[model samples]
Target: MRLLIFLIIVVPAAEISVLLLSGKTIGFIPTISFIILTGVIGAWLAKRQGLQAIKRVQEQISYGEPPGDALLDGLCVLAGGIFLLAPGFITDFTGFFLLIPAGRNIVKPLLLKIIRKMIDRNQITIYR
Candidate 1:
């Protein structure tokens, strides 16, 4: 809750400041264009990665193995896509990070740790 509150206040302020600074340095048109460009690239990357994850999940299921990792990858890609769609430098950077395989791999352990904590706290329940 505290983290959420902090993000709600700090993220917008930071984004606005960054956008203003970039606009001042690069001009308004270029700044807007850059944001749009990132969004377009992120959407394309997200779709490609999401399809690959689905393929991996299908392959694992066909082999009678759990698709846990693939599912997690898909979730990350989905979240990245969402973040990319939002208009802000911070979100775009984070979105691209999650969209990239290496970046996702780097963050996966942390995400898994958080999820485990949630489960332990009974905040989340897995049915199957």
Candidate 2:
């Protein structure tokens, strides 16, 4: 709850400050153009990555294997796409990082650790 609140308040505040600074440093038109370009690129990357993830999931399913990793890839792609779509430089950077396979790999262990912690703490419950 506290983290959620902090993110909701701090993230926008930071984004706004960064946007203003970038606009001042690079001018409004360039900043807007960069944001638009990132959004377009992110959309394309997301679609491509998403399709690949789907293919992987389908293949895994066909082989009687769980698509857990593929689904996680899809989730990362989805999150990246969303962050890139938002009009903020920081988010665009983060989105780009998450969109790439290497970047997703970097984040995966951390994400798994958090999920494990949550499950251990009874903050998350899974049914099979």
Candidate 3:
């Protein structure tokens, strides 16, 4: 909870500062163009990854297996896309990592570990 609150406030503030500094150094037009390009690319990747997730889920269902973490993966992708859509280099960089397959693979395990710990601590509950 504390971490979430800190991230919510600090990340955006940091991003804004970085964006302002970069804009001042590189000029506004280039900075805007970079932000827009990232947004467009992120959107395309998000759509493609979303479709892939759906397909994987369908395949699992057909095989009598649950989709399980696929839903979590989809949510991460969505969050990453939203982060990328936000206008800032820090957010865009973080979003890119989340969107990338290799990055997703690395982050997923860490996230699952944290989630498991939270569940074990009774900080979070899983409902069927």
Identify the candidate with maximal lDDT. 1
lDDT, candidate 1, 53-128, per-residue tens: 9999999999999998898899899999998988989999999999999989988888899999999999999997
Runs off by more than 4 Å, candidate 2? none
What lDDT does each candidate get?
0.94, 0.91, 0.86
**Which stretch of 10 consecutive residues in model 1 shows the poorest summed lDDT?**
5-14
Q: Which ten residues in a row have the lowest lDDT in candidate 3?
A: 67-76
Give a tens-digit lDDT track for model 2, residues 1-128: 99999879988899999999999999999999999999999999999998999999999999999887898898889899888877898899999999999999998888888889999999999897
Q: Rank the candidates by lDDT, best first.
A: 1, 2, 3
Q: Model 1, residue 118: displacement in angstroms?
A: 1.8
Write one digit per residue (lDDT tens) for candidate 3, span 1-128.
99999878998899989989988999999999988998899889988988887888888889988786786677678879888878789989888888888888888888888889999999999886
Candidate 1 global lDDT: 0.94
Candidate 1 lDDT score at position 90: 95
Total clashes in model 3, counting residue pairs 3 or more apart in sequence or in different chains: 0
Candidate 2 pairs with clashing backbones: none
Ordered by TM-score, highest first, the candidates read 1, 2, 3
Error of 2 at 23 (Å): 1.0
